[model samples]
Target: MKHPYTKLLANIIAYAASIILYALNAGGSINGLTILSITLATIASINLVRAITTITERKQQ
Candidate 1:
């Protein structure tokens, strides 16, 4: 339960950083930064979803 909360916090931080990087990339031409940021954001969002699901399951149990 506590670890889930920590994971959620980490996911939030990662997601936020990725979004910031993405925004910065958007202003510029296509490059590795844009690709990397997008990829990281996607991964972070997925992890966030998983963390939320785990939390929910634990609560149900």
Candidate 2:
């Protein structure tokens, strides 16, 4: 789908997957790589949300 919602959903799912993996791999304590991956994933999700919001706003105009 070309709709912004698609991007939003995909981003959310990807972020969730990364979070789950981090939790699984670094049970009690988080490792450096895990932290890095999670940080990158969160940034990616935020970017996706921003892009989607821009798309919706453009469509509205």
For TM-score, the strongest prediction is 2
Q: Which residues of candidate 1, in runs, are more than 4 Å off?
A: 1-29
Listed per model in order, the count of residue pairs whose N, CA or C atoms clash below 3 Å is 0, 0
lDDT of 1 by residue, 1-61 (tens): 2654666677677777767666777676546777687777777777777778888789889
* Backbone clashes in model 2, listed as residue pairs: none
lDDT of each: 0.72, 0.77
lDDT (Cα) of model 1: 0.72
Q: TM-score, each model? A: 0.53, 0.62
Clashing pairs in 1: none
By lDDT, who's the top model here? Answer: 2
